[model samples]
Target: MKTLGKTILLAALAWAASAHAVFAPGEKVIVLNSGDGSISIVDPVSRKEEKRVPVGKEPHHLMATPDNKELIVANASSNDLVFLDPKTGDILRRVPGISDPYQIAYSPDRKWFVSASNRLDRVDIYHGADFRLAKRLPTGKVPSHIAFSADSKLAFVTLQESNEFITIDLGKQEIVWTMPTGKQPAGIWMTPDDRHLLVGITGESHLEIYDWRARRMVKRILTGLGAHNFVARGDGRHVFLSNRMANTISMVDQQTLEVKETFPVPGGPDCMEITRDGKQLWTTSRWIRMVTVVDLETKKVLHQIPVGKSPHGLYFQSHAPRQ
Candidate 1:
């Protein structure tokens, strides 16, 4: 009887350890449902959604605070930023008067916060410390994605309608230069070395690589069609770009700047986030209203979990750092 008791206790302890190992404590995947104005909280380990939290209207994009304490959801139609507790998935507060904040992010140095107003054709810069409007610079039609230089002195924005990429001087709070790009450029990512700017041409099947220092286009890396967004693997070796129309994800070597491999991801894969361990990728399927999980080892989609309508931005506290 005592031997059996000991065995049972050991089994129970093992079960507890396995449960904790599945997910890091206080970690949950959060995705923005733009079409339905809701947010989905999901368990990465079990691949199950825990709850659906209603947020402001047209919540399209999200970003973590510089301190990593709060997750800010930008509701473009509602003109507000909803702050949520990253661990608890609870609404902390909402700041209003942010006009058409389609996409928002902080500078690398955390000195400035910028929002791209897609519908209004403007870019608003705010003081990062207090979220005060410092400047509202006019941009081309439909400013979509944004990226900051390594030193935080400059910010690059993609004009979807105008098919151009513009640089803004954060210190001067003015436009520095503008250059033409492929049609409907949606995602902009700066390489880790800060040597080049990669603009995903959503209307085309290639990514434009621009030499920012020389102010010229260097080369174009061809991938699947509707090259929408990018996320670094945080391993300092590779980055993943989602091709929405082609329904695939391409892995590119950061150093060689060459396409290493491509994996099929159905349902119009859009935004992406990588796991902390770099074993898996989480991406939102904007057309199918689901989140697809891709296994890096096999380079295949393992499964998908249903979320709300038109899921766009996705994030988790325990994710790999954006390179």
Candidate 2:
């Protein structure tokens, strides 16, 4: 098998040369949680590790600032958030006090970074620009993941224990609505139009679509096993789901509510991110201790780049034009 970086496929053939929508040239970055108290920075296009920075422990998820200059990582074991410089992989700041910060999301305006702490059963909000503590909002129990509306007016947080999705009004910084969802929904994502929220049924391998305006379940799609992380294509018609237990990725059609295709991945793929150009879909395999890059259009594994053990999460820098 060809190793990552060594094997290069024709970007035109792989992506149909459709203006390369995923990662921009000369300006792409990859963030991976080592799952052993460290985080590594890699250039997605070059497949080279820039630096490895140590954190508290078991970094569960990560989010980059709006400008893509700084990265905030959730250290689940230590119950804190670690901030770092993405280019050099240096620790710049560490925010302590969250309990089991498992997942994170940024507001549409990118002004606030919100985290869901499973152990503390609360949601902690941080000012993105200054990295300051804004407000800690309490939830029902075991908040796993969070998502923000496109308008940045509201945030939907999944409370695993309560089996409900809590809606927080960003302006008031408080919970305004609670909508019940499937059992143990772990990850939450919003559709491109911001008209629906997709809740992953972590316990049973299913996906539930909730209409934002109607505030109810519209459709439920059956995926195979331990569905966790989800990523949507730029067109908003296709959504990719990671089946953690099955070691595979499933492509679902949004309009038809059907799984269009499934492809094998390296160990159990946890979290995934597609390049800004849409040429590739990258996933971190925890057990295999590597990052798997797949040609989304071909549905074939292009290369596997080795990283630290138990890679938990992956984050790609959004494309930004030069200032």
Candidate 3:
């Protein structure tokens, strides 16, 4: 009887562990539909759309607060920010008077908040704690994306129409310098060590590596046509880039700056997010109005779930930490 009871207890423990695995039933993946201004809430385990909630007009990008309490979505056309519960996809409140917040992000230190105005050709800096406008810096034409330095003292912005990269000093609230880049630079990402900047040249088909200290192009990594955006794979060594025109995603080595693997993804793969266990990749299919789930190890698309029109940004609470 004693041995039997011990065996039963061990089996119960195993069952509990399996029940609490990541991507369990209550967890969800959020997708932003830019065309229809709706948010699709998906279940990762069941791989189904749970519900759709209407947000503001033209919600392009989103980011969670530093404290992880609220997820803020930037509505460019409406000129407002909608705060939502990160776990439940419920709207908490809406804050207005933000001018064309196309892409928004918080600094590493959580002291500054910056938004790039794609149509207004300006970048707005706000106090991280109170969300008050600190300064409005006039950038070049069409500021599309933003990336900050490690220390949070400087920020880098990509100008899509002007074909330039500009850096702003956060403390002084002024443009420090600007340098020319490839045609139509859209996404900008800083290396982990803050030594190099990777600009996704949407007009061309390559990524330009620029040295920030020296202010010069170090090298160019030839990716698929329309290299658009990047996201780290949670591992310290690898990063992934979405090549929109080529309809492929490239796995790149961070240290060597070489393309390790390239997987064919369809329907204009724009933005991406990885699962917490790092076994799957979720990307927004802009043209197809769907989201594609790819098996990381096998490099095969597992499923494509139809979403609203023009899906762009994707997020989940249980995501792997960005490298």
Candidate 4:
């Protein structure tokens, strides 16, 4: 049944028809306040927070559906998902009973959804749009982030506390192997060609590049202290890495595996989103409780909009690809 899984056609069509309410101009940026159990909607024009709405507990990460119609916020402590209007940050619906969904994402193939239960130390594989649980596999500890192969046949999860990375064979519904990572690996990313896997070492000051097909570390680039998360540059040439301890973010060449440049950003940059034209960046500053806007051309912060405590994840309806 896993191989034969498919989304309900009627439901997808209905949702597509109703999606006209989204993708409007003046789309707001949504920031998840993990410490406050609420979210802030920022007016893109003024670069200020316009409104704050309560969502759920410990909402750490979020992503758009494969169809790009709805935004899914994973409320870790609440153990549920809150779907919202991608354009306005309005509540669309809630799906409960998901256990400890700290970081959630849908595979590129649109065949599977994965939740990394950081607290429960497990990974749950859900099939299709209904998100029915298909398998529960326990990881060692603190599964922090996830990235999938382009074909979506494999899922790579980083265990922050265990210092390991694991790959899930989606077709088999099982983890095929576990390998050692750097100290406190948090963010995992795959090159577009799926040739390399970049592991962010949060406990260290560098990134470890692994050849996934060869299952070995190929290169290590010194980024900054406590490299924690990643965001694509939208140009397809480079990707940005945030270093919490160093208070800086490094831009790395995706092909050459070199640190092209590093820029200073204050207060522990976590998750990030970019503008469609690739000129501006909106990132969450966790320790400082602010949503920062940076001018990519100058590599300087343009505005630091105060929101709530511990803003972790961020998104906007019109933005660059999450590559």
Ranked by TM-score from best down, the candidates are 1, 3, 4, 2
In terms of lDDT, the best-performing candidate is 1
For all predicted structures, in order, the TM-scores are 0.93, 0.82, 0.93, 0.92
Once superposed on the true structure, which residue ranges of model 4 sit more than 4 Å away at CA? 1-24
Q: Which pairs of residues collide in model 4?
A: none
Clashes of each: 0, 10, 0, 0
Candidate 2 lDDT over 1-323, as tens digits, reads 46543444555345433333454554435555555677777765567666676777888788776767787788888878887776455689888876667888779798887878887888888786665778898889899888888889898898888988999998889999999987888778887667878888877778888997798898988775777778876565888888887778888777776788888886888788776666678888888888888887788897788778788877766522211
Report the C-alpha lDDT of model 4 over 1-323, residue by residue, as the tens digit: 54334455554554344322333456888999999999999877656799999999999999888887999999999999999988889999999999999999888888888999999899999985798999999888899899999999999999999999999999998899887988999999998778999999999999999999899999999999999899998778789999999989999999889999999999899898877768777789999999988888899897899999999999998787766
- For candidate 4, the TM-score is 0.92
- Runs in model 3 deviating more than 4 A are 1-20
| Model 1 pairs in collision | none
Superior candidate under lDDT, 2 versus 3: 3
Q: What is the lDDT of candidate 2?
A: 0.76
- Superposed model 2: Cα runs more than 4 Å off: 1-29, 43-51, 96-100, 128-132, 318-323
Extract clashing residue pairs from model 2.
Answer: 20-277, 21-276, 21-277, 22-275, 22-276, 22-277, 22-278, 23-275, 23-276, 23-277
